[model samples]
Target: MKLLFSLTSLFLLICSTALAYDNEPNGFKGLKWGTSIEEFKNVYPNATLQKQQPGEYNPANIITYIVPINESKLSGITITSPFRYSFYNNKLESVLVTFTGKDNYETLNKQKILLNRMSMIYGEINESSGNNIDEFIPGLSTSYYNFNYCWKGTTTTINLNGSYKEPNLSSYLSISISSVEIRKQWLSKVKPIDKTEWSKIRKNIISEYRSDW
Candidate 1:
Protein backbone atom coordinates (compact mmCIF):
# COMPACT_ATOMS: atom_id res chain seq x y z
CA MET A 1 0.00 0.00 0.00
CA LYS A 2 2.81 2.42 0.86
CA LEU A 3 4.46 1.72 -2.47
CA LEU A 4 1.26 2.43 -4.34
CA PHE A 5 0.71 5.71 -2.45
CA SER A 6 4.27 6.82 -3.15
CA LEU A 7 3.84 6.13 -6.85
CA THR A 8 0.63 8.12 -6.92
CA SER A 9 2.27 11.12 -5.21
CA LEU A 10 5.15 11.09 -7.64
CA PHE A 11 2.79 10.94 -10.58
CA LEU A 12 0.83 13.89 -9.25
CA LEU A 13 4.01 15.87 -8.75
CA ILE A 14 5.11 15.27 -12.30
CA CYS A 15 1.72 16.24 -13.66
CA SER A 16 1.71 19.51 -11.68
CA THR A 17 5.15 20.44 -12.93
CA ALA A 18 4.15 19.72 -16.49
CA LEU A 19 1.02 21.79 -16.13
CA ALA A 20 2.95 24.76 -14.75
CA TYR A 21 5.43 24.69 -17.60
CA ASP A 22 2.72 24.28 -20.20
CA ASN A 23 0.66 27.17 -18.87
CA GLU A 24 3.51 29.61 -18.35
CA PRO A 25 2.99 32.89 -20.11
CA ASN A 26 5.12 32.92 -23.26
CA GLY A 27 4.76 36.57 -24.25
CA PHE A 28 3.02 39.87 -23.76
CA LYS A 29 0.27 40.67 -26.24
CA GLY A 30 1.18 39.41 -29.74
CA LEU A 31 4.93 39.03 -29.19
CA LYS A 32 6.85 36.25 -27.47
CA TRP A 33 9.89 36.36 -25.26
CA GLY A 34 13.30 36.70 -26.96
CA THR A 35 11.83 38.56 -29.95
CA SER A 36 14.33 40.72 -31.84
CA ILE A 37 14.38 44.49 -32.07
CA GLU A 38 14.05 44.62 -35.84
CA GLU A 39 10.66 42.96 -35.65
CA PHE A 40 9.58 45.61 -33.16
CA LYS A 41 10.42 48.40 -35.56
CA ASN A 42 8.80 46.61 -38.47
CA VAL A 43 5.62 45.88 -36.57
CA TYR A 44 5.33 48.95 -34.39
CA PRO A 45 6.77 51.57 -36.70
CA ASN A 46 5.57 54.43 -34.53
CA ALA A 47 7.00 53.21 -31.23
CA THR A 48 9.22 56.01 -29.95
CA LEU A 49 12.57 55.12 -28.44
CA GLN A 50 13.27 56.41 -24.94
CA LYS A 51 17.02 56.33 -24.92
CA GLN A 52 19.89 58.64 -25.77
CA GLN A 53 22.19 57.45 -28.55
CA PRO A 54 25.28 55.62 -27.35
CA GLY A 55 28.51 57.58 -27.71
CA GLU A 56 30.22 55.11 -30.06
CA TYR A 57 29.71 51.57 -31.35
CA ASN A 58 28.59 50.17 -28.01
CA PRO A 59 24.92 49.24 -28.39
CA ALA A 60 22.49 49.94 -25.54
CA ASN A 61 21.54 46.73 -23.78
CA ILE A 62 18.39 48.11 -22.17
CA ILE A 63 15.96 49.87 -24.49
CA THR A 64 12.41 51.07 -23.97
CA TYR A 65 9.60 52.21 -26.25
CA ILE A 66 6.69 54.50 -25.38
CA VAL A 67 3.59 54.08 -27.54
CA PRO A 68 1.79 57.38 -27.93
CA ILE A 69 -1.99 57.74 -28.00
CA ASN A 70 -4.43 60.56 -27.54
CA GLU A 71 -6.18 58.47 -24.90
CA SER A 72 -6.06 54.82 -23.90
CA LYS A 73 -8.53 52.79 -21.91
CA LEU A 74 -7.63 49.48 -20.31
CA SER A 75 -10.19 47.32 -18.45
CA GLY A 76 -12.83 50.05 -18.54
CA ILE A 77 -10.45 52.48 -16.87
CA THR A 78 -9.46 55.55 -18.89
CA ILE A 79 -5.70 55.94 -19.13
CA THR A 80 -3.19 58.02 -21.04
CA SER A 81 -0.56 56.86 -23.56
CA PRO A 82 2.52 55.93 -21.51
CA PHE A 83 2.59 52.22 -22.09
CA ARG A 84 6.10 50.75 -22.23
CA TYR A 85 8.01 47.92 -23.83
CA SER A 86 11.38 47.28 -22.22
CA PHE A 87 14.01 44.99 -23.64
CA TYR A 88 17.46 43.76 -22.81
CA ASN A 89 20.01 42.87 -25.48
CA ASN A 90 17.32 43.51 -28.13
CA LYS A 91 15.00 40.91 -26.63
CA LEU A 92 11.73 41.90 -25.08
CA GLU A 93 11.78 41.59 -21.26
CA SER A 94 8.80 43.32 -19.67
CA VAL A 95 5.92 45.76 -20.05
CA LEU A 96 4.79 48.40 -17.54
CA VAL A 97 2.12 51.11 -17.52
CA THR A 98 1.22 53.42 -14.66
CA PHE A 99 -1.96 55.48 -14.56
CA THR A 100 -2.26 58.58 -12.42
CA GLY A 101 -4.17 61.86 -12.17
CA LYS A 102 -7.44 60.88 -13.78
CA ASP A 103 -10.96 61.68 -12.72
CA ASN A 104 -11.11 58.51 -10.67
CA TYR A 105 -12.60 57.70 -7.32
CA GLU A 106 -10.99 58.71 -4.02
CA THR A 107 -11.94 55.55 -2.17
CA LEU A 108 -10.46 52.13 -1.60
CA ASN A 109 -13.78 50.66 -2.71
CA LYS A 110 -12.82 51.50 -6.24
CA GLN A 111 -9.68 49.39 -5.93
CA LYS A 112 -11.74 46.49 -4.59
CA ILE A 113 -14.05 46.85 -7.57
CA LEU A 114 -11.16 46.77 -9.99
CA LEU A 115 -9.67 43.79 -8.20
CA ASN A 116 -12.89 41.83 -8.64
CA ARG A 117 -12.92 42.65 -12.34
CA MET A 118 -9.36 41.44 -12.83
CA SER A 119 -9.87 38.28 -10.80
CA MET A 120 -12.64 37.21 -13.15
CA ILE A 121 -10.19 36.92 -16.05
CA TYR A 122 -6.93 36.05 -14.25
CA GLY A 123 -8.51 33.42 -11.95
CA GLU A 124 -7.04 33.17 -8.47
CA ILE A 125 -4.70 35.52 -6.64
CA ASN A 126 -1.30 34.09 -5.85
CA GLU A 127 -0.53 36.23 -2.78
CA SER A 128 -1.96 39.46 -1.45
CA SER A 129 -1.98 41.55 1.76
CA GLY A 130 -2.76 45.14 2.75
CA ASN A 131 -3.70 47.38 5.64
CA ASN A 132 -7.36 47.72 6.57
CA ILE A 133 -9.24 50.62 8.16
CA ASP A 134 -9.13 48.94 11.55
CA GLU A 135 -5.37 48.57 11.37
CA PHE A 136 -4.80 52.28 10.97
CA ILE A 137 -4.94 54.77 13.81
CA PRO A 138 -7.89 57.09 14.26
CA GLY A 139 -6.90 59.29 11.30
CA LEU A 140 -4.11 57.80 9.17
CA SER A 141 -6.14 56.46 6.29
CA THR A 142 -3.99 58.21 3.70
CA SER A 143 -1.27 55.55 3.75
CA TYR A 144 -3.64 52.66 4.28
CA TYR A 145 -4.06 50.28 1.39
CA ASN A 146 -7.29 48.36 1.14
CA PHE A 147 -6.02 45.44 -0.93
CA ASN A 148 -3.50 44.11 -3.44
CA TYR A 149 -3.59 41.14 -5.81
CA CYS A 150 -0.99 39.28 -7.83
CA TRP A 151 -1.32 36.56 -10.45
CA LYS A 152 1.60 34.30 -11.29
CA GLY A 153 2.38 31.98 -14.17
CA THR A 154 5.32 29.63 -14.35
CA THR A 155 7.48 32.25 -16.09
CA THR A 156 5.55 35.50 -15.76
CA THR A 157 4.33 37.79 -12.96
CA ILE A 158 1.51 40.32 -13.11
CA ASN A 159 1.08 42.91 -10.35
CA LEU A 160 -1.65 45.46 -9.74
CA ASN A 161 -0.66 48.19 -7.29
CA GLY A 162 -1.45 51.82 -6.49
CA SER A 163 -3.83 53.84 -4.34
CA TYR A 164 -4.81 57.30 -3.23
CA LYS A 165 -2.79 58.97 -0.50
CA GLU A 166 -5.18 61.72 0.46
CA PRO A 167 -8.61 63.15 -0.08
CA ASN A 168 -9.12 65.02 -3.34
CA LEU A 169 -5.89 63.37 -4.54
CA SER A 170 -5.46 61.28 -7.64
CA SER A 171 -5.63 57.53 -7.22
CA TYR A 172 -2.71 56.02 -9.11
CA LEU A 173 -2.59 52.42 -10.30
CA SER A 174 0.27 50.54 -11.96
CA ILE A 175 0.20 47.24 -13.80
CA SER A 176 3.39 45.44 -14.76
CA ILE A 177 4.09 42.23 -16.66
CA SER A 178 7.51 40.61 -16.84
CA SER A 179 9.52 37.49 -17.65
CA VAL A 180 10.95 35.62 -14.65
CA GLU A 181 13.70 33.59 -16.28
CA ILE A 182 15.61 36.68 -17.26
CA ARG A 183 15.33 38.12 -13.79
CA LYS A 184 16.58 34.92 -12.13
CA GLN A 185 20.02 34.99 -13.81
CA TRP A 186 20.38 38.65 -12.88
CA LEU A 187 20.14 37.79 -9.20
CA SER A 188 21.96 34.44 -9.35
CA LYS A 189 24.62 34.00 -6.62
CA VAL A 190 27.17 31.93 -8.50
CA LYS A 191 30.88 32.29 -7.99
CA PRO A 192 33.07 34.54 -10.09
CA ILE A 193 33.57 33.55 -13.71
CA ASP A 194 36.85 31.93 -14.68
CA LYS A 195 39.37 34.21 -16.37
CA THR A 196 39.89 31.66 -19.12
CA GLU A 197 36.18 31.70 -20.00
CA TRP A 198 35.35 35.30 -19.11
CA SER A 199 34.31 36.33 -22.61
CA LYS A 200 32.24 33.16 -23.10
CA ILE A 201 30.43 33.59 -19.79
CA ARG A 202 29.68 37.23 -20.50
CA LYS A 203 28.25 36.33 -23.87
CA ASN A 204 26.05 33.69 -22.30
CA ILE A 205 24.63 36.15 -19.78
CA ILE A 206 24.07 38.82 -22.42
CA SER A 207 21.92 36.36 -24.30
CA GLU A 208 20.25 34.92 -21.18
CA TYR A 209 18.12 36.90 -18.75
CA ARG A 210 18.65 37.90 -15.10
CA SER A 211 15.32 38.90 -13.58
CA ASP A 212 14.36 40.32 -10.17
CA TRP A 213 11.34 39.38 -8.13
Candidate 2:
Protein backbone atom coordinates (compact mmCIF):
# COMPACT_ATOMS: atom_id res chain seq x y z
CA MET A 1 0.00 0.00 0.00
CA LYS A 2 2.78 2.42 0.85
CA LEU A 3 4.55 1.79 -2.46
CA LEU A 4 1.32 2.21 -4.40
CA PHE A 5 0.55 5.51 -2.71
CA SER A 6 4.04 6.83 -3.45
CA LEU A 7 3.74 5.96 -7.13
CA THR A 8 0.38 7.67 -7.37
CA SER A 9 1.77 10.80 -5.75
CA LEU A 10 4.72 10.85 -8.15
CA PHE A 11 2.43 10.48 -11.15
CA LEU A 12 0.25 13.34 -10.02
CA LEU A 13 3.23 15.58 -9.52
CA ILE A 14 4.53 14.82 -13.00
CA CYS A 15 1.15 15.51 -14.57
CA SER A 16 0.88 18.80 -12.74
CA THR A 17 4.31 19.82 -13.96
CA ALA A 18 3.42 19.01 -17.53
CA LEU A 19 0.20 20.99 -17.33
CA ALA A 20 2.03 23.98 -15.92
CA TYR A 21 4.59 23.95 -18.71
CA ASP A 22 2.11 23.49 -21.54
CA ASN A 23 1.43 27.05 -22.76
CA GLU A 24 0.86 28.84 -26.01
CA PRO A 25 3.14 31.50 -27.39
CA ASN A 26 3.08 34.93 -25.72
CA GLY A 27 0.39 36.81 -27.61
CA PHE A 28 -3.25 37.85 -27.22
CA LYS A 29 -5.94 38.54 -29.81
CA GLY A 30 -3.49 38.04 -32.70
CA LEU A 31 -1.39 40.94 -31.42
CA LYS A 32 2.09 39.91 -30.35
CA TRP A 33 4.44 41.82 -28.13
CA GLY A 34 6.23 44.66 -29.91
CA THR A 35 3.37 45.16 -32.39
CA SER A 36 3.55 48.66 -33.81
CA ILE A 37 0.76 51.17 -33.23
CA GLU A 38 0.00 51.48 -36.93
CA GLU A 39 -0.10 47.72 -37.30
CA PHE A 40 -2.49 47.44 -34.37
CA LYS A 41 -4.80 50.02 -35.98
CA ASN A 42 -4.67 48.23 -39.31
CA VAL A 43 -5.79 45.05 -37.62
CA TYR A 44 -8.55 46.75 -35.61
CA PRO A 45 -9.88 49.73 -37.47
CA ASN A 46 -12.52 50.55 -34.88
CA ALA A 47 -10.01 51.04 -32.09
CA THR A 48 -9.76 54.61 -30.87
CA LEU A 49 -6.38 55.93 -29.86
CA GLN A 50 -6.02 58.36 -26.99
CA LYS A 51 -2.89 60.00 -25.64
CA GLN A 52 -2.45 60.36 -21.91
CA GLN A 53 -0.94 63.53 -20.51
CA PRO A 54 2.56 62.89 -19.19
CA GLY A 55 2.87 62.92 -15.41
CA GLU A 56 5.68 62.47 -12.91
CA TYR A 57 5.14 58.75 -12.47
CA ASN A 58 4.37 58.19 -16.13
CA PRO A 59 6.91 60.35 -17.86
CA ALA A 60 6.75 58.49 -21.14
CA ASN A 61 4.30 59.77 -23.74
CA ILE A 62 1.99 56.79 -23.22
CA ILE A 63 -0.86 56.33 -25.68
CA THR A 64 -3.85 54.04 -25.21
CA TYR A 65 -6.38 52.54 -27.61
CA ILE A 66 -9.85 51.49 -26.65
CA VAL A 67 -11.02 48.49 -28.69
CA PRO A 68 -14.60 47.45 -28.43
CA ILE A 69 -15.21 43.74 -28.04
CA ASN A 70 -17.38 43.62 -31.12
CA GLU A 71 -14.41 44.67 -33.22
CA SER A 72 -11.83 42.23 -31.79
CA LYS A 73 -11.84 38.44 -31.64
CA LEU A 74 -10.40 35.96 -29.17
CA SER A 75 -9.84 32.42 -30.33
CA GLY A 76 -12.47 29.84 -29.36
CA ILE A 77 -14.50 32.41 -27.42
CA THR A 78 -16.65 35.50 -27.79
CA ILE A 79 -16.35 38.37 -25.31
CA THR A 80 -18.17 41.69 -25.43
CA SER A 81 -16.02 43.57 -22.97
CA PRO A 82 -14.04 46.54 -24.22
CA PHE A 83 -10.26 46.07 -24.35
CA ARG A 84 -7.89 48.86 -23.44
CA TYR A 85 -4.41 48.67 -24.99
CA SER A 86 -1.54 50.78 -23.78
CA PHE A 87 1.46 51.57 -25.92
CA TYR A 88 4.75 53.08 -24.85
CA ASN A 89 7.26 54.31 -27.39
CA ASN A 90 4.93 53.13 -30.16
CA LYS A 91 4.92 49.49 -29.00
CA LEU A 92 2.10 47.61 -27.37
CA GLU A 93 2.79 46.77 -23.74
CA SER A 94 -0.43 45.93 -21.94
CA VAL A 95 -4.13 45.10 -22.40
CA LEU A 96 -7.04 45.56 -19.98
CA VAL A 97 -10.65 44.28 -20.03
CA THR A 98 -13.29 45.51 -17.63
CA PHE A 99 -16.89 44.32 -17.15
CA THR A 100 -19.52 46.09 -15.07
CA GLY A 101 -23.20 45.21 -14.89
CA LYS A 102 -26.15 44.63 -12.58
CA ASP A 103 -26.10 40.85 -12.76
CA ASN A 104 -23.47 39.36 -10.48
CA TYR A 105 -23.72 35.78 -11.69
CA GLU A 106 -23.49 36.78 -15.32
CA THR A 107 -20.33 38.75 -14.67
CA LEU A 108 -18.83 35.82 -12.78
CA ASN A 109 -19.70 33.39 -15.58
CA LYS A 110 -18.06 35.62 -18.12
CA GLN A 111 -14.94 35.89 -15.98
CA LYS A 112 -14.80 32.12 -15.65
CA ILE A 113 -15.05 31.64 -19.39
CA LEU A 114 -12.29 34.13 -20.02
CA LEU A 115 -10.06 32.49 -17.40
CA ASN A 116 -10.64 29.05 -18.86
CA ARG A 117 -9.81 30.24 -22.34
CA MET A 118 -6.68 31.94 -21.13
CA SER A 119 -5.67 28.83 -19.21
CA MET A 120 -5.90 26.71 -22.35
CA ILE A 121 -3.43 29.05 -23.95
CA TYR A 122 -1.32 30.06 -20.96
CA GLY A 123 -1.43 26.75 -19.12
CA GLU A 124 -2.71 26.20 -15.56
CA ILE A 125 -3.40 29.31 -13.53
CA ASN A 126 -0.45 30.39 -11.41
CA GLU A 127 -2.52 31.75 -8.51
CA SER A 128 -6.16 32.61 -7.83
CA SER A 129 -8.49 33.64 -4.99
CA GLY A 130 -11.57 35.68 -4.05
CA ASN A 131 -14.25 34.24 -6.33
CA ASN A 132 -16.99 35.33 -3.89
CA ILE A 133 -17.69 38.03 -1.39
CA ASP A 134 -16.31 37.28 2.06
CA GLU A 135 -18.69 39.39 4.13
CA PHE A 136 -21.46 41.97 3.84
CA ILE A 137 -22.38 44.83 6.12
CA PRO A 138 -26.15 44.97 6.61
CA GLY A 139 -26.57 48.55 7.81
CA LEU A 140 -24.22 49.99 5.17
CA SER A 141 -25.32 47.42 2.54
CA THR A 142 -21.83 47.02 1.21
CA SER A 143 -20.03 43.94 -0.10
CA TYR A 144 -16.32 43.27 0.33
CA TYR A 145 -14.19 41.64 -2.30
CA ASN A 146 -11.87 38.71 -1.66
CA PHE A 147 -11.38 37.97 -5.37
CA ASN A 148 -8.35 37.90 -7.65
CA TYR A 149 -6.77 35.55 -10.22
CA CYS A 150 -3.35 35.70 -11.82
CA TRP A 151 -1.19 33.88 -14.34
CA LYS A 152 2.43 34.38 -15.24
CA GLY A 153 4.43 33.14 -18.22
CA THR A 154 7.89 33.62 -19.59
CA THR A 155 6.92 36.87 -21.27
CA THR A 156 3.54 37.84 -19.96
CA THR A 157 1.45 38.30 -16.82
CA ILE A 158 -2.35 38.18 -16.68
CA ASN A 159 -4.73 39.13 -13.88
CA LEU A 160 -8.50 38.71 -13.39
CA ASN A 161 -10.31 40.33 -10.50
CA GLY A 162 -13.91 41.12 -9.53
CA SER A 163 -15.55 43.28 -6.86
CA TYR A 164 -19.08 44.20 -5.84
CA LYS A 165 -19.96 47.73 -4.80
CA GLU A 166 -23.52 48.51 -3.59
CA PRO A 167 -25.54 49.02 -6.78
CA ASN A 168 -23.33 47.65 -9.56
CA LEU A 169 -21.03 44.66 -9.98
CA SER A 170 -17.67 45.06 -11.68
CA SER A 171 -14.73 42.93 -12.81
CA TYR A 172 -11.33 43.67 -14.31
CA LEU A 173 -8.85 41.58 -16.30
CA SER A 174 -5.51 42.59 -17.72
CA ILE A 175 -2.43 41.16 -19.42
CA SER A 176 0.99 42.68 -19.68
CA ILE A 177 3.44 41.20 -22.19
CA SER A 178 6.83 42.41 -23.26
CA SER A 179 10.36 41.24 -23.92
CA VAL A 180 12.96 41.76 -21.22
CA GLU A 181 14.75 44.48 -23.19
CA ILE A 182 11.53 46.25 -24.03
CA ARG A 183 10.36 46.09 -20.44
CA LYS A 184 13.65 47.54 -19.27
CA GLN A 185 13.40 50.42 -21.68
CA TRP A 186 9.78 51.08 -20.80
CA LEU A 187 10.65 51.09 -17.10
CA SER A 188 13.42 53.57 -17.70
CA LYS A 189 10.98 55.88 -19.39
CA VAL A 190 8.35 55.71 -16.67
CA LYS A 191 10.54 55.63 -13.57
CA PRO A 192 8.85 57.31 -10.61
CA ILE A 193 10.13 60.72 -9.56
CA ASP A 194 11.50 60.96 -6.05
CA LYS A 195 9.44 63.81 -4.66
CA THR A 196 11.44 64.17 -1.43
CA GLU A 197 14.72 64.24 -3.27
CA TRP A 198 13.37 66.75 -5.75
CA SER A 199 12.26 69.02 -2.94
CA LYS A 200 15.66 68.84 -1.34
CA ILE A 201 17.36 69.68 -4.62
CA ARG A 202 15.07 72.66 -5.14
CA LYS A 203 15.73 73.92 -1.65
CA ASN A 204 19.47 73.59 -2.10
CA ILE A 205 19.33 75.53 -5.34
CA ILE A 206 17.29 78.27 -3.75
CA SER A 207 19.72 78.53 -0.82
CA GLU A 208 22.69 78.70 -3.20
CA TYR A 209 21.02 81.49 -5.21
CA ARG A 210 20.40 83.55 -2.06
CA SER A 211 24.00 83.13 -0.92
CA ASP A 212 25.32 84.18 -4.33
CA TRP A 213 23.35 87.45 -4.14
The C-alpha TM-scores of every prediction are: 0.61, 0.59
Q: Which parts of model 2 have CA positions greater than 4 angstroms off?
A: 1-21, 51-59, 71-78, 129-141, 167-181, 192-213
What tens digits encode model 1's per-residue C-alpha lDDT throughout 16-125? Answer: 11112224467776887677778877877888987532221112245778776448766776554477777776787667665544433433433555567777767777
Task: Provide the global lDDT of candidate 1 against the true structure.
Answer: 0.52
Please identify model 1 stretches exceeding 4 Å from their true place. 1-24, 51-61, 101-110, 133-140, 144-147, 189-213
Q: How high is the CA lDDT of each candidate model?
A: 0.52, 0.51
What tens digits encode model 2's per-residue C-alpha lDDT throughout 76-178? 3444457777777888776655543335555555556766777676677776665443343212444534345566445665555554433333322333333
lDDT of 2: 0.51
